[model samples]
Target chain A: MEFNFPPGLILVLGAIALPFLKGKIQQALIVLLPVMTLVLVWWIPNDYTLVLSFLDYQLSPVNSTPTGRLFASIFCIMTFAGGIYAMGQAKILELTAAYVYAGSAIGVTFCGDLISLFIFWEIMALGSTMVLWAAGSQSAYRASFRYLMIHLLGGVVLMAGIILHVHTTGSTDFTAMQPDNLASILILVGFLVNAGAPPLSAWIADAYPEASPSGMVFLSAFTTKTAVYALLVGFPGATILIYIGLYMVFYGIIYALLENDMRRILAYSIVNQVGFMVCAIGIGTELALNGAAAHAFAHIIYKALLLMSAGSVLMMTGKRKCTDLGGLFQSMPQTAINGIIGALAISSFPFTSGFVTKSLETAAAASQGMVAVWFLLIAASAGVFLHAGIKFPWFVFFQKDSGQRPPDPPGNMRFSMWGFSFLCIAIGLFPGPLYRLLPYPVEYQPYTASHLVTQFQLLLFAGFAFFVMLPLMKRTLTISLDFDWFYRRFLHIFAKEFTVKTSNTHIRIEHAIHQRIERFIKRLYRHHGPHGILARTWPSGGMVLWVAIMLAGILLTSALL
Target chain B: MISDQDKHWFYRSSSLPKLWMIQVFILVIALVPEFVLHHHPHFQENGVLVDATFGFTAWYGFLSCAAMVIAAKILGIFLKRKDSYYDE
Candidate 1:
């Protein structure tokens, strides 16, 4: 049977009914929608394009390719897992927004035209903003506004780029392009903004942490990963992304190290992880693209898993700061174990999902013999273990006891965490299935003896460094500044100053004009008033004399001619 | 009401040393493979080795992490502000 409509629409349409439904029905739909979407994602045959005639153009609203399928598959799985996790505690609004968010992300992957891609891109933005808004805190509300401003700005830029690109190239296909013109550069900037790249990288850490525990799990999965997918497809082999990606990687590490909020730390690491994918996309080889895609898939599962663990703690304990949490393993044993598994996976420990998937990118880099890039990637790998891999679990679940023993999150959340944890190990142990889904043929192995040994040495020693540097790594009640500060503080102050100064200058100018006009009017009154020289009653004789002179002059001129 | 006395075995002061010892043992075990296994260098060119020095990954990992921690600390002096920095 052929399914023509975009599969993501299933979730998008289904989610609309959620707020109206109650109890078992809503719950059932929550689980059922993603499953149906997944089935439909597969049911759509390869290379199938559902085209619609719009004006002078053909739009492929639904296009199926291996890369799109890979991303769509993960989006479906994430929605499913996130649904289960959020089922118990998330408000109806959050659940609804998240589903829409997930669906649109899927829609973006399957887009065959720039216009269709853009439409889905916008919906994803609105959906994610709504999800953040549903957290229902003052911070969440405020942060949602900031998040919206940035995304809308990005969307405008993207739209402008698309218009220019289509006008220049006279084609609307969402295929790869060289960054040789204004339009393509704008598009790349637009994609980078969503990928948590620099100058705006602070958005991930600033906004994602403000979400409700479950809200964050959903937030962690979609926006940036979708951006990665877009970049992988749209701007492959763009070398500039490598430097940008590396900046994000270290930026994530440094900031996460200083972060006090557990969720914020994870939020920063999302930037870090996306940095890896962005870097690999910059590499732009088939293997690098494959690695970027595979890493994104693995990243979503483990990142969600990590956030789930953090979220569980947030929900049960009513605290999010690392300084406020410790020794939670006793009460939340399953959560801690799952959290550790996620940490290990993120660190790319042997026999975990990250190790297998991440190696593909590095292998690509190594093959190219880009020595500096390779070394930096290796260093960043170690940095990942330090900040997210060890620091997250160590401080949150171990460290000094804060005397809070919150029990494991309720059944559904636990179920979701275990499910993802299982996938992390399962994929790590058997990468063949995942590798086959890559856009390119799989020609790499991850478990060679040298590879295994080096990975252990790198991670273990990084772990050792963490212990040695424990004194400096103490959590504090502070936040490190990022580019958001420009808008959050600097632009705010600038706007205030601008308004204040402009209004003051306006008043001064008005007063000066008023005074000048009053003076001019006074001078006019003095000269032209009834008692003044020009207003005197002798005007009749003067008028008669002037008239006679004018008549005489005219007669003389006529006679001379 | 759980008390400090009810601490998990993993966190117990007695077990802390044991955990440390285990960590040290694993670190040793990880290095043992460096001697036993033939190393393949990924960043070599022609005949010159760029990255596969003896215990390179191990030391590099340790030093890089330490550098990051210190760098964060130094940067904290300039960038760190109270959690309520934005609220006001």
Candidate 2:
């Protein structure tokens, strides 16, 4: 269908206007914007494309491929659910920034060229960082600065890659990119950083938990998923991503297991979840790509649901650590049930959303005879259950009571949780509709005896392992060592020590020079005062001798030259 | 006595019955396709059975769980300190 107005753009503008509306009107606008975006997303025709010609390149601002539509649809749904969750909170700025963030993520999906994607990418960085800043704590401010530094660095890499790619290919059209050139590799590095790939993956855990409870819900949805969208569009078949993704999956679980902060654990799991999608994209078959896209779609829903549940507990208890939280399920049943659904879904338990979407990746690996990759992927799946799927719910909801009985979150929060929980189960039960929305045709089925039995054995055994090792899983107050220590502690200490040492050296040098000057002055004073020949001088004789000596020195220098 | 009971079921207790119930529930769900939905497309083909029986899901699941559990256990050996480990 040919459209006159940009529906996505209109929804974004409406979201920007929401916080200004005041009271219930703001809430209405919050819900209305995402629903409106979803409608706009559906209304756009599958084949319809919009392109604008720049100086030497063409930029498509509106593209409606099934892949783009699927991501945009889920992003819109996230904004809607996030809006409902954050409705009664006092931080309007965070609410606005979140919409802008979500909108730009949708913008990234619809973008058909490199420049357009870059523009939306930076906008998401700025908007999400603002949400972090809106958390209204000193630590949040510091963490947001670090967060901004990483994203800006990523943006610089992305921009440089795009410029090089355009210079090389004479085209900026966002299409399936093969890593044959330096430019594409650079672009992939940029995308991998945002996708929470290793080495740089520490940024997510370090910064996200510092955000406001509602702010984190928004933080969880946009940035990494947009990177996944970029990867799907740009470098689908890059072989190296398979190993990189595998590293991230295990890295997330291990560090999360070591973490005490509830939100940090979830933040780590985002990397873990996105790793699966990245691995799927790396596989690059039609089924694998579909699995990646569908998982991203399903992931945003369930992950947000999971974050919202954690956020609710943080909101009620004023605690964000596992050691400080427990037995909340008794009072917050709605939150508890919804959280359990999210946990189950993330674990890939049957009748949950994860079961349908995640299985496709494993199936893809097997189909390709990538035995090692498939093995690692399955192990990561079980690890996912161990760390996030079961650990999160068990520790946060059902562990030893901390004797703090906070009431359930507000009605709006409950409603939002219920809404996302329903979506998680509904999609799991009916995978057909989701499958149809994928970019490719769907033929793979999720339910079968062997599939069930094996998935069961794996997950159940993983649970058994969890309980068996419960003694080792006890929460502690210590922060796990991550790559951030290089910046947060080591470099910081090195800088401090260097400053002190250099300043002390400067003081020593100044003192020595001062003493030398003082000694010289004292000698000069003593000589000139009463004790020296000059002090007792016959003035004419002294002047004559001094003049003769100066002449002699000048004459000697001239002779030497 | 009440405190002991609380510790038994809720905290320190093994509660094998609850664990078994969870297992049974998982097994029933896992076997649903074979017994009840026998006509399902996934089962109509032998790929699913071969893939499952040949250690696709079982191996993947067990190995992943084992890796995580082992890692946690190993880390706990060194990393798990008293609740006040960092306080000093």
Best by DockQ: 1
Evaluated at residue A278, the lDDT of candidate 2 is 91
Q: Which pairs in model 1 have colliding backbones?
A: none
Give DockQ: model 2: 0.33
- Docking tier of model 1: it is medium
Q: What are the chain A TM-scores of the candidates, in order?
A: 0.91, 0.89
Q: Which pairs in model 2 have colliding backbones? A: A379-B64
What DockQ does model 1 achieve?
Answer: 0.73
Clashes of each: 0, 1
Per-residue lDDT over A1-561 for candidate 2, one digit per residue giving the tens place of the 0 to 100 score: 456444456555776797668877877788788898889888888867787787767888888788899999888888888888898773988988888888888989888789988998998899999999999998899899999999999999999999999998888888998888889988998998899897899999989999998999889988999999999989888898888888888888988888888889899999999999999899999999999999888889888998999999999889988998887787788888998899889989888889999999888987787867876787888888889888998889888877677898999889999999998999999999999999999998898765666677678768867776788777877677667767776888899999999999999999999999999999998888777767885679889999999999999999999
TM-score of each: 0.91, 0.85
Every candidate's lDDT: 0.93, 0.83
